[model samples]
Target: MGLAERRKVMGYSQERFAAVVGVDRTTVGRWDRGETTPEAIHRPKMAEALQLGLAELDALLTPPPADFPECTASPPCDRHGSEGIDDMIRREFLRIMVVAGSLTTLAPDDADAIAEAVDRGSAEDFRLMNGHLWQVYQLARSKSSVNTVVKDQLGALNEALKESSRAGGLYEVAGDLFQLSGELSFDGNRYTDAAASYALAAEASSHARAYDLWACALVRHAYVDVYERRYTEAAETLDVARRVAKRGNSALSTRYWVASVQAEVYAGLQDLGACEKALGEAQRVADLATPVHPGGWLRFDGSRLAEERGARYVQLGRLDLAEETLRRALETKTLSRGQSFRRRGAVLVDLAAVGAKRHDAEQVVTYGGEALRLAKKTGSGYIARRLQALQGDLRTCRRNRRVVELNAEINAL
Candidate 1:
């Protein structure tokens, strides 16, 4: 058992544990995520709370070897037993092999070495690489640049699906891969392809009995409708997502992320009360004691809640709320490393839109110019798309020379 498991054994919520250790709640989250270590002074208190001696606490803190999946560092252990672990490794290894290309093509000795390593639990190799690819996708300047890797992963997953049984854990991996593929399609503005990918993801997640993954896929599918301006259809789809998420593991922020997107759908439908309620549900993610997301599939964590809420406010034509909330989101971005180019870019565009709607050319040029630079720098079609959508609002400030110039630059993009 690790610190998270031990803390639960000791009946300490993450908040209580952090308070006992004299640290912020998020600091505890970082520790649970293995992103940071406790200071020496904090270790003793941590050990005491976890009911472990200092040396034993150190052992718990030490990561499992890169080869083994002793346990994932976050979300705690939901599956138990050696049989479950073995089945998971067996199928996951199939995926790993496919990612490495044809196994038979490998030198005989190299192939033999991999077979031996699998017995010693080398599935972590594939697991970590999958997680790394997600980080790469999130941080890459050009979102579409991750397509080749995603396509390869999809090929592997489809192959695995051919022989794998339901509930064998490969389905969960399939769910993850399908979501990544959908994201790539969405970034390329292929809404139909994205929707199809999400549907497959949902099907895989359902077969796996992974409620969180299943719910998130539905949310993404609904977003395709939202993007096409089908607010009624999107709202209907998101309502189903919310129900599925209620069946999800509450430890993860799956429901909250669904609620977050639902807020956007409601905003599009011009239901201010429903939008506010959904945002409130999303905010409840912060009240959870453990890390909100696994950083792999469900990355809600409430880190971008401010920005999303602000954006929804913009959609609802509440300029004052949008401006104040988005400004707070900007300030909040500095505190968390989880902020991405897409996230911040979306926020800047909303702020710029707020300015346009209010007929404030200074706000328009100031925020819009910065957003334009991000669009160019990251080559993010999402940012450029947001900018394109703001053109009609820009007419309100057409008299401003800087606005005219910025419009020209955006047009070029």
Candidate 2:
């Protein structure tokens, strides 16, 4: 049965179903008409609203022709294997929307519609949309689909930006969107794009006077400069970010977080004393207890000190120190969660990079393999870049089939 039929069977009017699903009535109409499908992620909630078991609801929702990839291809199983296929297809479909908008310029009306959708969208919507875009961005880079994918989303992104500015004003929303945009650009290796996005993010945060958000953007922007080997520019950017952070919020730990990042910028500039001093300052700020983090994404509650220290040592080519600090950091796994997979994986990649510099292929393979796994799981560009930098070391291990696989994976990423 179609959605409308199923809802009627459950004694739910279209209006009731729409209300239960937290969507508009028109959205329900679209679902009933099969013009659009409910997101897989929302299936469980939909099932609950229909008073059906999650599995049973899914079975009922499944289109006869769709069959879901696994049910048709795989051997029958006790559980519904179609769920996995459904998720994969859903993920790819969302990714395609972002890519299509980015590669082929969206129609003016379509662009406007996307803008409206974003402006009125919840954080959950942004997460679902951007998460898929990020995955595609990862695959596109590895598969050399860069031109087609990255270019296609630009028009929609521009439209989204205009809408974000109009709707977000000078507050958290604006800062959040700016940071997301900056990170996306940075992931694509478009440093200039990253810098521009970060600049606007910082400005918006400043208008809201949110110290942490502003400082985080500055730090993100500094990363681009660091990547370009422009140490002076990176240091200057961090310095400015630091000053703003210090003045804006004494209650906030953003200054300290920026201080930690700045330490690396100092290391990049070969300023050992300044780097150490900044580290000390970061520790001092981190010592304070806070009930809540100001910004969800910008939370630098000072818990990542070990990783920060390891990163600094890595920058200085002090492999021994880097390994020790990174190992210690890994020991404190409490700070590392699913969301922090990308950050922890980055540290692992750096450690592997250090092992590579020392011609320790065993160490490289051990750490690099794990890091590569994490990179694939998280789609982290930072980790991928670090692995890329270890190419020279991989060459030294040409005879090892494991290293061959590692190189292929890193190259693919």
Candidate 3:
């Protein structure tokens, strides 16, 4: 029997079952509809409420395939023992990775060898390869091209984790891979999946005693809240990230990244004084001569500070400041070279937003058009989303033919 049938057999209504499980009625409804599974925390309560053992609960919850038999004999045979079950689970994980297009290139032997190397405490090669994958992911014009390799790396890390003898180094590598997974999800606008990946990254980093990696994951997770307009939640998450960053290496500039993101959260909250203070803290990273990012995962080196500051100013409705900062960002060598279309597109969109605020239709058309083109060329959901925001601003100047055309073009993207 499924969850709904089990609940009915127990003589408990959906509302009462939800109360017993300490969740909303809609959550119970979602489970019944197969929309989402119970989170880890809620599963025990659900089992208790149904008066069922964990195994029995799992069996009921899982729908059997058409070819699978329902045992008619008493005391079902335990054909797949613990070892078999574990092997099956791993196989299923690999199958899902294949279906998701995350493990296309690497052979099973290659994955096994990498995992074995990590388990034997020789993780340098694995780490270096993962770092190269991250660099490729960042520099590639089509971000999705790197997903298969990253996913393959994650699969190898998971295999290594099954052996606990050398877990410390494996955890560290796993943390980095999780962060890369989060970045891939975020770039595709899968915010919920990104948040889950970041949460796992933080947990793995904590187990490895890698404070900077943990804090970086927290910062990335906070972005989900920030983008969703959960300002208070984002601020609270960033505050924890800041405290964690304090315990990380002073040479790494992790704290500076925390400060930079804090500025964005502050701008979202409209706290101008706090925003400026955080921005000032982020600026200190520019003074550090040595490279701050070792793995290419935490790539915030203050090169994009001008554009970031402009974005914060735009968030705060300071058009005069935003226009100047973004224009300066456009002139910066990094942006001027056009190597990073995502960065340039963001700056252009912000500048167009400023122009829309100032009712300068010509400026809006010029910047917005270029941003739209970059969005198409790069297939960047980040840039497309920013243009959607610009679309709202252009509506105010809809009377202008240029503004109307630009708005339509953005909508097409």
Among the numbered candidates, top TM-score falls to 3
TM-score (C-alpha) between model 1 and the true structure:
0.68
User: What ranges in model 2 sit over 4 Å off?
Assistant: 1-171, 181-200, 335-340, 376-379, 392-409
For candidate 1, what is the total of clashing residue pairs? Answer: 0
Backbone clashes per model, in order? Answer: 0, 7, 0
Determine which window of 10 residues in candidate 2 has minimal summed lDDT: 147-156
Q: Is candidate 1 or candidate 3 better by TM-score?
A: 3
lDDT of 2 by residue, 231-269 (tens): 898888988988887776677677787788878788887
Q: Relative to the unseen true structure, what is the C-alpha lDDT of residue 370 in candidate 3, on a scale of 0 to 100?
A: 92
* Best first by TM-score, ranked: 3, 1, 2
The most accurate candidate by lDDT is 3
Estimate, for each residue in 196-226, the C-alpha lDDT of model 1 and write its tens digit.
7788778767755788999999999998998
| Clash pairs detected, candidate 3 | none
Which scores higher on TM-score, 2 or 3?
3
lDDT measured at residue 92 in model 1 versus the true structure, 0 to 100:
45
Q: lDDT values of the candidates?
A: 0.75, 0.66, 0.78
Per-residue lDDT value at 379 in model 3? 92
